[model samples]
Target: MTRGKWVAGAVLSAAILVALVVAGVRIWDVHQMTSDWALWPKEVPSKVQFANRDYQCGANPMPNTHSLDGLTKQGKTAGGADIYSAAPGTQSGTATWIVIKTGQATYTCDLMGGP
Candidate 1:
């Protein structure tokens, strides 16, 4: 190929590579953000929950209760967040609140599930 053709092909290839990388990064970021709990579970006494202090509950007052019974149970704990559920049971709907504290951070959320 001529010199000009070679240079054009190189530039095109570089652009395509950069585009692919940007796309991949965006996809990964979306997955990470959605998978982790941003707030629902509780709060940290020192720090607020993800820029949201409007719903800061001190602790998991009703820990044993099955908010959802069978559908899906979700909560925040120890600055971490989780969801739980039972199997082969009636759907009692979901509970509304769960909270946990760790050092300077808190995780809080409303759960829905259990008998």
Candidate 2:
């Protein structure tokens, strides 16, 4: 084989290897993100009423309950649930609970224990 042909083959092989590695990394990342959460027995409600306003949990962009209406991130539970305070200056009595599983986030007005 010509020297030029050999070099081209080597470059093509390297490119393929790099592409495979990148794809594998992305897949691993997705799996990690999804599997990191602990399982919750009950499904997250589609909508939660807080401060007399309904917030959708399953929407494309999850509500930023952590920073919305004076709600702040209290902390993460052992089961990987993110806890947020209710909106300030409102009669919302309970803290918000957020759990992520299978790459989707669900929210509730009650505190759900962590994994």
Candidate 3:
């Protein structure tokens, strides 16, 4: 192969490698953020009723209202708890009332507003 062509191929390969590394790092971050809540038992109910309102696990969307990964990234931490909005940002009345107990391997949801 021509020297110039070989150099071009090397540059393209390096670019692809950089892209893959960036993608992998992002995926790893997301995985680490959600791993705590994602492994909760499916048979166990994560729902909680507080103030006559129903609040479910915020990790998964199918059975919950918000993504845990999104919550962890965007939520605020206070008094050993991670507080997040009950609903997604697009929705109105998204109260930052959902609290998750932190500093443990697994998190427990406390809709009652306690850490």
Candidate 4:
């Protein structure tokens, strides 16, 4: 190919490589964010008096997420005491529901600017 064409091809290849790298990095970051326990808050609903329905009836098994890769379930800690969101873009502030030992659900969310 001509010198000009070769240079253009090289630039295009470099651009494509850069784009791929950026995409991969972003994916990795998202994975880490969702799996991070520090980002998750404590007090997740562990036990509740469901007057209407059971929390374990496929409703409170755990926080689930639907992403491009498909449904991703939250992972429990090594102790298997609590669960957390494993997929990013699932919740607004925190991942799924936190295991709250005691608290008023409607009182206020410190992170969501509640009372």
The CA lDDT at 113 in model 1 is 32
lDDT string for model 1 (9-114, tens) is 9999999999989877765554343333333223232222321222323333323333443344333333354433333244443334334433433344443232
Query: Which candidate ranks first by TM-score, i.e. highest?
Result: 3
Q: Which residue ranges in model 2 land beyond 4 Å of their true spot? A: 35-70, 73-96, 99-115
Runs in model 3 deviating more than 4 A are 36-59, 62-115
What is the TM-score of each predicted model, taking all chains together?
0.34, 0.37, 0.39, 0.34
Off by over 4 Å in 1: 36-115
Question: lDDT by residue for model 2 over 1-115, one digit each (tens)?
Answer: 9999999999999999999898777655543433222233123333333333333444233433233344565444333455455445554454444332322443544333321
For residue 1, model 4's alpha carbon misses the true position, in angstroms, by 0.8
In the order shown, what is each candidate's alpha-carbon RMSD? 10.8, 11.1, 13.1, 15.4
Model 1: lDDT of residue 24? 73
Question: Could you tell which candidate, 2 or 3, scores higher by lDDT?
Answer: 3
lDDT of 2: 0.44
Encode model 4's per-residue lDDT on 1-115: one tens digit a residue.
Answer: 8999999999999999999898777655543433223323233322221212212212133333312233243333222333322256754544322231222321111121121
lDDT of each: 0.41, 0.44, 0.46, 0.35
- Decide which is better by lDDT, 1 or 3: 3
